[model samples]
Target: MLKKIDQAALFLEKNQQVFRCPFCHEAMKAKDKTLFCSNRHRFDLSKKGTLYFLKQHVKTEYDQKMFQHRRALILNGMYDPLIALLAEKCQGERVLDVGCGEGSFLHLLEQQATLLPSVGFDLSKEGVYLASDYNQKHFFCVADLTNLPFNKGTFSTILNIFSPSNYQEFARVSQSNGQVIKVVPRSGYLKELRQAFFPEDLAKQHYSNEAVIAKFQETFPKMERKIVTYTFEIPENCQHSLLEMSPLEWSVTKERKEFLQKNLLSRITIDLEVLIGRFSADNMKNM
Candidate 1:
C-alpha cells in the first residue's frame, strides 16, 4: 500500500520545481525531474502524486487507528463550525496544511471552495497514505514541519490545526502577505475525558490559554485571535475514537477506559481558539 502511494506521489512531482531540501533546509536542484541537493542528498517524488521529503526519521504518536477515530469524530459534525470558520477566514489561491492528518479539513475546504488548491503534510506516513486515499486531487505528502520541502514564499496561506507550530519554518515558506491560521484547543476542549481520567484534579493544569497567546505573540506581531466554542452530542458508538484521538487515551488507565466506555455521554463540548496572523518582517524586532 505504501509503495503504491509513493509511486503515485512521484508522478505528481514531474512538473514541480525543486524547492528547499527537507533535511538540510538548503536549496535543491532539479536533476532531470527529481530533486537533489549538493550534499548528495536525493529525494524522489512519489508516483502516487505527492512528495516524499522526510529525511530524518522520527516516530509520531499518531497512527492509523488514531486517525480513523479522529475521522469519525470530525465527520460527525462535531467541528463543522470550526471548519466553516476556517473556510471563511482563509483567503488565497494556494493553502498548505502543516500536520494535516487524513486531510479532513482539506475535504471540508474543498466542499466550501472547489477552486482552492490545497496541500497537506504530516510526519506520519500512515496519515499521509490515508490522506492521499481520502482525496487524490489535492496533494498530500509525508513531510516535516521544521524542514518543509517547498520553496520560500510558495504558499499564500498555511494552517496548523491542533498541531505543533514551527514559526520560523512557517515564516520562511509563507508569502509576505500570507496568513497562518492556528487552531488550538481551548479550555474544556475534552472535558468529558478529563472528567473520567482526572476527576480528582478537575480544576488544575488544563490546556493553557496564556501559553497559547504568548506563543503566538512571540511568533507574529500583528495577529488576531478568535475563540470558538460549540457543543456536540457524541453518540455512544463514536466515543471510542473521540477518546482515542486525545492525550487522555495515553493517560487513561485500562479501568478508566472501561469506565468511560460504560458511562460515555452522548454529548460533549468542542471548544477551540483560532489564532489568525499575518507575517511581518518588522515583527521580528519584537522577538
Candidate 2:
C-alpha cells in the first residue's frame, strides 16, 4: 500500500491544475511535495500532510478534539440520511467539499459512490490536520472559502455543508453545467443542545432560514431546498462527542456543558435544509 504521504502527494499532483497561488492567484503545481506558482510563490505540504493554500493562516475554535468527535459522530451513522441524500443529489464525480472538517463526509461519500477526484478544503488547519494525518485517501487542504485557490470552472460539483461560503466564488470556480449543494441547519437542528445551553431563552431556542433561502434563490435561479428532519440515536459513548463537536456548545456555561456530558442524551434531532443550486445560462457568462 502507498504510504499516506505518498498517497496525499499523488492526489495533490493529479489535481494541481485546479490549485492556484494564494499570493499571485496563478496556477500552482505540486513540485516535490511543495506547490509552486509561476511567480515563485510556494507552499510546502506540512508534516500533517495538508497544504496551506490560504493567503494567511487562520485560527478558529475548531480544534483537533472537535474534529475527532465530529469524525466519530459521522462514523456512527448519525448523518447517514443526509449523506444518502447528498449522494443522490451529487451530479458529478469530481466533488469538492468546502469546509470539509476531518474528511468524514467526503470520505464516506466516496465510499458510497464512485466519485473520482474527491477533494476537501477547510479554513481550519486543525481540522485539515485531523483529516490528513488520519487518512490520505482524498485531498484535504487548509483554504479559506472567501478566497478559494482554484482555477475558474474547475469543479463539476461544490458542496458547502453547514459552512460559510462565497456564492460568487462558487459560481466562478464551478463549471458552466455544475451543481452547488449547500446544507444549512434548520430551526430544530440540535434542539436538545440548544435547550440545554439556553433553556429559558425562547428566541435562542428557535431558528429560521427565511433569509438564507432568499439568498440561495437569488444566487441560483434554478434552486431547490429539501428539508431533512430526523431524530438520531447516538450511543452513550458517542453522545459526549456530539457535545464537543458542535459550535452551539461554545456559548454554554462550563457547568451546563459538564452536566450535559455526564447525563448523556441518546437521541438528538438532525434538522437541516439541503439547498441545490444551478445557475441559469444567461447568468453563467456574467458570473
Candidate 3:
C-alpha cells in the first residue's frame, strides 16, 4: 500500500522553502489551503498535491511514453552501478534533481540511504505526476530548470543525470558550499543501438572530454571526473521500450525496427562520465 500525498498539506508545509514567487521572489507561505506571498500574490495547490508556478511553458521532448520506457530499462538494473557511485558521492543534506524523469534516481537514492531531504523537478507534468505517485515523502514538481522558482542558496546538492544542464540557474539555487553531480553519456553508451540502427557505419563518435573539463573548470576550482561503464542485456520484450526510450527510435525507421527485431541484439554498452564539482566562495567570485 502506497501513501497518497496530500498536495495541499505538503505544499503548505514545504512551500516556503521549496517555492518562491517568480514575480516578487518572495517565499510562498501556505494560508488556509492557499499559497500566498507577502506581496499578496496567491496560487492554489492542486488537488493532487502539486503546484504549477512556471513563468513560461515549453514542450518537453521526453514524455509519458519515454518515461515509461526509461522506467522499464532502469528497473532492470541497467544503471545500478552509476546510481551506487552517485549515492557514495552525495552527502545528502538537501538534494535537488533538476530533471528527475519519473523519480527513478530519487527512488533509488531512497532505497540506498536515509537522505536528509530530497526534491525533484521536471518539465514534464506526466513525469512529476508519476513520481509523486511513486513516493509521497519525496517532493516532486513540474518546473523548468532554465527558470527555477527557488530562492538562491537553497539546495546543498544538485543532481543532473543524462539531462539538460542549466548551470547558471543551478549555481544560483545551490548553496555556496553545495556540490553538483552531473552524468554525461560517453560515446560507447548504447553502441548496440547504433549498431542495430546503422549497421553500415559503426564509427564511434568521439566525446569531447576536454570540453567537459573546460566548462566545469570555468565554474568550480575543485572538480573531479570519473568514468563508469557496464554491460546490460536488453530482453527481446524490453527492446521496443528501450528503442522508444531514446532519440534513436525516430532516427531508426520502421524497416530498421523490424529488421532489428528479426535479428535483435541482446545486450548494449552503458558508458557514462560523472562529473562532481564543489563550489566555493572563491569560485563564485571568479564567476
Candidate 4:
C-alpha cells in the first residue's frame, strides 16, 4: 500500500509530462525525493512532503504566523460560501491552485470530497508548509507564479483567489479548454477593519476593483463577473484572526494593531467579485 505522500507523488508522476525544470525549462522526472532534469538541475522534495520548484529565494510579509492565522480563519468556515461556488464551477480531473495560501481552501475541498487530485502552489514556503502539514490528501509546492514549472496545457482548471496572477503563465500551463476562476475584493470587503484602522481617512475605507477587472477582461476573451457581498457576524473570539489574516493590516502601526487585536468586530462586510472565464484568442493561439 502507498503512503499518503507517495499517493500525492503519484499524482505528480502521472502528470510529469507537464512539469519542467525551473532553471532549464526542460522536462523533469520525479524520483524518490527529488525532481531532476536533463540539464542536471534538481529540486528537492521538502521535509513536509511537498516539492520546492523555485529558482530563487522569496521575501514577503506572509510568514508562518500570518499563514497560521489565515489557516485558522479558513478552517473556521470564513470562506465556505465562496469555496462552495468555486467547487461548483470547477470541473476537471485535476485542479491546480495558483498562489494557494496555507492550502486550507483546497484541503477543505478534499475533505468534502470535491476534488479528484488537487495541487497547490505558492511562493511562500510558510504557506506551502502549513498546507502540506495540515493535510496529505493534496499536493502542495513552493513555486513562483511568474514562471510556473508545469508544461503547456497541464491543468483543466486553475484557481487564483486573493492572490497575484500571471495570465501568461496561467495560459501556458492550462488545458486548451481550461477555465480560470479569479476572486477580486470589492470596496466593502472588511469594511469594519478599514473603519477601525482609519477612523478619519474616509478614502481609506473603500477599495476599487476596476483595474483588476479590466485586466482580467483583457487577459481572457470570454468572461463574466459576479458580485458576492454579505455581512457576516463575527464570533467574539475570532475577531483577532479576522483582523490579522488580511494583508491590509500589514501597514498598520503597532499601537493600532494592538487596539484592533484587542477589540472585536460586530459584523464584517464580505464584498467580492468572482470572475469566471477562458483564455483569449491570442492566448489560445498557443494551442
Q: Would you list the C-alpha lDDT of every candidate in the order shown?
A: 0.74, 0.82, 0.76, 0.79
Question: Which parts of model 2 have CA positions greater than 4 angstroms off?
Answer: 133-135
Per-residue lDDT for 117 in model 4?
63
Q: For model 4, how does the per-residue alpha-carbon lDDT over 156-200 read when each residue is reduced to its tens digit? A: 788889888888788888887788889999988888888898888
Between candidates 1 and 2, which one is better according to TM-score? Answer: 2
Candidate 3, pairs of clashing residues: 7-49
Candidate of highest TM-score: 2
List ranges where model 1 is wrong by over 4 Å. Answer: 1-15, 24-40, 45-50, 203-205, 284-287
Model 1 C-alpha lDDT per residue in residues 172-267, reported as the tens digit of each score: 778776788999887878776677677787564376677877889777767788888877988667976777875567866789788877776677
Candidate 4 accuracy as lDDT: 0.79
| Candidate number with the higher lDDT (2 or 4) | 2
Better of 1 and 4 by TM-score: 4
What are the per-residue Cα lDDT tens digits for candidate 3 across 1-287? Answer: 52343544654576467678767878878766566789987766555566566766667777888888888888778889998888887745678888898888888877776676678888887787677766666677777677787888888889988787777888788898789988888878887787777777555333445576578767865788899998987776777677778766776678988877677667889989988998788775554
TM-score of model 1 (CA atoms): 0.86
lDDT of 4 at 248: 75
| Evaluation by lDDT, superior candidate among 2 and 3 | 2
**List of clashing residue pairs for candidate 4:** 18-151
Return the candidate ranking by TM-score, descending: 2, 4, 3, 1
Per-candidate Cα RMSD to the true structure, in Å, reads 3.2, 1.6, 2.4, 2.2
Q: Model 3 reaches what TM-score against the true structure?
A: 0.89
Worst 10 residues of 2 by lDDT: 278-287
Q: Which order, best to worst by lDDT? A: 2, 4, 3, 1
